[model samples]
Target: MYPADLVKPMREELSVVGFKELHTSTEVDQAIKQKGTTLVVVNSVCGCAAANARPGARMSLDNEKTPDHLVTVFAGVDKDATDTARNHMVPFPPSSPSMALFKDGELVHMLERHHIEGRPADMIAQNLKQAYEQYC
Candidate 1:
């Protein structure tokens, strides 16, 4: 597990933008199962997460249509929560710094790590925005 001090700022990057942090399996399950569209960000301490994923997620919210709930689970930090979130993302292998969108508790869209790494933040945001337009 990562020391809390090491991840506080990283967690704040999303928290400051209104993404609720899910630190336990139950919290993750509850957040995803809530009514309306929910966006789940499996956050990480990797370069792509800092350079692309988090920023892209924040940028995506600028859209007129957005998910009803925004939540995140920190990989390498919140083990149970991250694992639970990954279980919901089945069919796709687990990847850090990933994003998933769910409508009425069903997975609707997903952006895996490969989709974020080496990509510009705006391009990732545009991809998510497109998903939001359709699923949100």
Candidate 2:
């Protein structure tokens, strides 16, 4: 493991939520570019991440219809990879604890930080399940 001092909590938040780590820019691109629907979760260490986004994502994943691949880019921790991943999400500003659902290399659904902060986890999960139904 890399130093826990930097990236552990960020990783655990997503891991516990069932998201796979995509540590390299190449891995991020590969997951985004590969076949089938993919959910790119921009995981973060913010309170919103812990309180709403991560738990919500975990619940959504329990639904029968989920994305083919669940991947995460940890903001601040994976700076360049996160920046590169954000590039693929054009027109949206960078937001920690955001969620982006992609289909066949194109962005389809995006949940920004403002959409996540202070919301109920179930609400967030509902939105995610809707995105999964539509795109995944």
Error of 2 at 84 (Å): 0.9
Deviation from native of the Cα of residue 99 in model 2, angstroms: 0.4
- Residues 1-136 of candidate 1 have per-residue lDDT tens digits of 8899999999999999999999899999999999999999999999999999999999999999999999999999999999999999998999999999999999999999999999999999999999999988
The runs of at least 3 residues in candidate 2 whose Cα sits more than 4 Å from the true structure, single-residue gaps closed, are 1-3
Lowest-lDDT window of 10 residues in candidate 2? 1-10
Q: How do the residues 4-67 of candidate 2 rate in per-residue lDDT, one tens digit apiece? A: 5766876886777667887789889999997888888888877889889888888888787999
Note each model's CA RMSD in angstroms. Answer: 0.5, 2.2
Identify the leading candidate in terms of TM-score.
Answer: 1
lDDT of 2: 0.86
Q: How close is candidate 2 to the true structure, as a TM-score?
A: 0.92
Among all windows of ten consecutive residues in candidate 1, which has the lowest summed lDDT? 23-32
- Candidates in order have lDDT scores of 0.97, 0.86
